[model samples]
Target: MRNKIITVCTAAVMLVMTASCGADKNMKKGEKFLAIGEYYEAAIQFKKAYGKTPPKERDKRGQRAAKLARCYDRMNSHQKAIAAYRNVIRYKQDTPETHAALARLLLKNGNYKEAAREFQTVLDTLKGNRLAENGLESALTAQRKKEEGSRYIVRKMDVFNSRRADFSPMFYGDEYDRLYFTSTRNEAEGDELSGITGTKNGDIFYSEKDDKGKWGKPQTIESGLNTEFDEGACCFTPDQREMYLTQCTSDPAYPRYATIVTSNRTDAAWSKATKLDITRDTLSSYAHPAISPDGEWLYFTSDMPGGKGGLDIWRVRITGAGLGGVENLGEPVNTAGDEMFPTFRPNGDLYFSSNGHPGMGGLDIFIASPDKKTGKFVLEHPGYPLNSQGDDFGMTFEGPHNRGFFSSNRGDGRGWDHIYSFEKPEIIQTVKGWVYEMEGYELPAAQVYMVGNDGTNLKLSVKGDGSFTQVVNPGTDYIMLATCKGFLNHKEEISIRQTDESEEHVLQFPLASIRVPVLIDNIFYDFDKYTLKPESATALDELVKLLEENPNVTIELSAHCDYRGSEAYNKKLSQKRAETVVEYLIAHGIAKDRLTPVGYGKEKPKTIRKKLTEAYPWLKEGDVLTEDFIKQLDKDKQEMCNQLNRRTEFIVLRTTYGMFDEKGNLKNPPKPAKEENKHDEDEIFDIFIE
Candidate 1:
């Protein structure tokens, strides 16, 4: 009887408390919900409060109006936020913060020019305000970038999308015909609605193209990875054998923390997931896993302590057995705001989304590439349509090209992310090369390393026949070095001019043996004049490269006359010609001490080499050329002999150019090689790199 009386008394007290709470209504409820990150619900309550308060209570009405505007901004309702903010200024006196807040929201909604005005107003009132100053700069930058247009044509993937939130798309399988993504629609497998997102728990879904290359309706992935919790933001190992995804579990006692889990693929089915072992004890939340192209590192987003702020990008090394310690990506990449959804191109460029960095208001995508010399990652904004004021993230690529899909919530007032396809049309540029012996077979196992001014350093692989192709962006200078165990290292410098037309560059590294003369092919001097023609620059520059490659070995730059001019005249002319070649070499950076100019003239007649004999079967390898001897041959043979006789060649006089000094440091280091002797016919190899 006492317990029943107490229960009735307690119930009456609760009823009274509820009545008192409802009486105060609007402002209190809105503030409470806003504190808990419930922007949608808070906006509704604040709007009600703004309507109820009379204009006579100017301070109270303006405060409610400002809160309502903030709520709308948080919910990504741009138009409503603008209207409410305008009401705040009209009802009560304006302040610098309110104008700044409105300006920030306007910039996020892509109203760049209007945002600039609001930011200017804030600056005018409150001088030297960092936020206002930065806001104006960002608004102006975004305005200019948008006006310039963008290469990407972004459009909603309507066929694969539902009315609910769908995002974080990734390619599945080697064929890449299958696409997997996350969704929180009503049809999701979870039995409970999430209090955090106010929707069904996130689940993984997949869609595939039909025979006609059109996507069908997406189907839920029933691999048990999705439970009565959130599961999304997945990545695959380079081998595609293991899948890593984010899982957020709920706890009634405390707020939930997300973790990364790995699932192995067994016969096309995903096995049960196991939580990844991270290094830090302070990582409160872990999600959004991205594996490096080499599969050696796993990068993820974390809200762990010691971060820049909010959330930051961190990585752990993936060894053959297990994982390694966690390390932050640090500065330029992570900011005081949230940085999430990290992805990688096959070439090691990192793409991630952040609100910490200056952007179009919300989370914008930025690319970070490592500096080859400094090893520091430099951040770059892809700009415009690739990023926006709404939450844009989860970028995935088709390959190295400028076409891919990313997620955005720009058009949604409720901030629901959806998949959108973007592509930039461009002319493909490439560099192709072959490594072979000067007079022998191809050097199939030669190692070729390349470093570019744009911070690209990679060890290039070759095909069975010693051919290699690498895709290069226009306007970048690249130095490529090819080395074989038995031969000297060959260096070439390639300068790719920016052009809209698709093109290819070819470089041939004809490595010479310790003993032999290498002909500088396609080299020519003017008829009766020793001047080098513009057409001969290509060949002469290649000769300079050969000298630089075999630095320690001094070379004799010999010029031979065709035995048509007087012996005395030929000797003087050939001597001048050899000196001209040597001067050109010195001018191009080859040390003068490494070269000896020799004019063979008519003194040493031409002898057919194996390559020449093979091309002209009637000719023998030891056939000597003199004026009388050439007259005995056929007309075609005489012209060919004369052509071969009037040539420039380099014979190795020594093998060591001072590779290292007594202290083991290089005395005369080779400069980064510049490419030469390129011909128009080499453009045929352009398609190989593509």
Candidate 2:
């Protein structure tokens, strides 16, 4: 009986020893895989070792769990990482680093409250740890952001997504009907799996919209662009002539580094991609390229030195040669945590993904729009549905529309980024303006300076068609000044009222010609009489405002006759009309000596203008409306020509009106003040610190 009991004890002891040895072997294998950056394999090995570790050996089990959590974190298995980290905490292995890592994972998993607690714990232990402080701030903000939903409607595009990761979508071609993205599906071009991701190497896959505007099956770009090495995030020049792509070349013995490469467009496929020499800094990783609206700069993400964060958005001047002068975006745009995947809208708004900024969770998308007043970029977040507790990034717009596609990992616990379409049903409150000469065609060379009560100071560049459209906020007042080289300046002030729906207001700027007579339309008088009509009050008021706007200019206010009445009667009536205008002007604050009333009665005939020729195809420009010419015209044409001849016009007599003193000698005029929009020193300091 004694021998039997001893034998059982010996057998149990041997079994225990065997399990311990296996766990140790598994741990060593996991450490080896981790050293080589094979996170997926390392995770599997670590999980096995953790399962084999005995519950009685809490220290050993805790260490194994910690390793497993780290591996899962690297692999982006957020849910799994959270579970493993909880196990580490349960086993009393709660180091400051472990708490920080656990907090980050919880934050990524949408457990904002838990993340905040853990982040606070980390901050308490590791005093002044910027990463922990930032995480805490993010966690607290995530709770509020999650509660406040956004206007953006987001939905997964399953047809364009795969079981594995798919992300970084770009709209291509003229119609933006073609979509190109990176994927790790089974059908990816490469057979070899990434050491870092444990999935097939990323390849650039694309889909084209059919005649019905429906997306077709995604196809891999199987040219030299896709190799066994990972290739992803890509952008094109505005002209779409050249493509910039992110490439990660792996070495079995060392860690992989991401670098940007350029490919020239060919007739069929992209030419072989060549590495871009953005400085000789091979040690830093550069990825996620975006071209500015004017193609003057190349914006990308990098982990180089002098950045305000772990990964910062950097830009380099794009010259005829290679890139010149690399600069960090700095401060508010870059944070202690990672900021990656930069994209742009046609209006020069920069969109990017960040973990450092206060957000809903994970890598939330943010916009950095330039403040026209301060010349600084202001950050904004599109809350809720557009952003989630999962990694959301890689946004692409269809031209200037707000509706577009982005990548998110929301419902996928595996953290595999999938393409999701997002659209903010536009509440487009805008101001569309036309700046032109008073009686001539549009002035395309004009420039408009705008100032809004909401601290908006924008220098608007007019389109070739002499039009400008700008989005505006509700209940704001905007003042705009239109200026052209050969025309007098015109100013308009508008008040945008708050409304329940979108509205577009139109403003017309008719700058008076400095070299020619500007006919004032809408001025009315009694039939064959000199008495001013009540409707003429509005038109005369407008002229009064114009005169006040250009205070230094003195004008010749003239009235003409229609050549129907006798020359003496027409001259006498025209003289009375001119004097009436001068009297109204003097009553409205005009200096008496500044006005020179002229009566041109049937002597100077009117010539057809471009606008008139367009309105009446029978009439051509340079055609004069003389008495004989009017006699040959039809009844309607004769009346129109007669109306054109009986008009009131103003031409600048002198621009230096008030520059002369009573002595007739020229007095020095106060230098025209230069108006510029600049931020005060305190505002700049706040921006830098922020």
lDDT (Cα atoms) of all candidates against the true structure: 0.78, 0.86
Which is the leading candidate under TM-score?
A: 2
Q: State in Å the error of residue 150, model 2.
A: 2.1
Q: Write the per-residue lDDT of candidate 1 for residues 1-690, one digit (tens) a residue.
A: 999999999997786566445534977877777765566667777777666665566877777788888877765667888888988898765688788778877888878889999999998998976557767877878766666667778989987677778889888654467788889988787687664556788888889877787888898775766677788999887656788999887664444578999898887788777888686563388999999875678999998888888799999988777887779989889876689999997667999998766677678888999987797999987778878777899988765456778899887876788999988887878787899887556776787777788866666655446776678978899878887876767888899998877677889988876566677777777889888888989878776766666666788888888888788998999889999989998999988988899998888877766666767798877777878889999898889888878878778777756767999887645445446533222232211121
**Tens digits of per-residue lDDT for model 2, 289-377:** 99987677999999999998689999999988768989999977999889999999867899999988877778989999998768589
Deviation in angstroms for 83 in model 1? 5.2
TM-score of 2: 0.63
Residue-level lDDT for 357 in candidate 1: 67
TM-score, predicted candidate 1 vs. hidden true structure: 0.57
Off by over 4 Å in 2: 1-21, 427-690
Q: Model 1, which residues run further than 4 Å from truth?
A: 1-20, 23-74, 79-101, 117-132, 277-283, 429-690
> What is candidate 2's CA lDDT for residue 29?
87
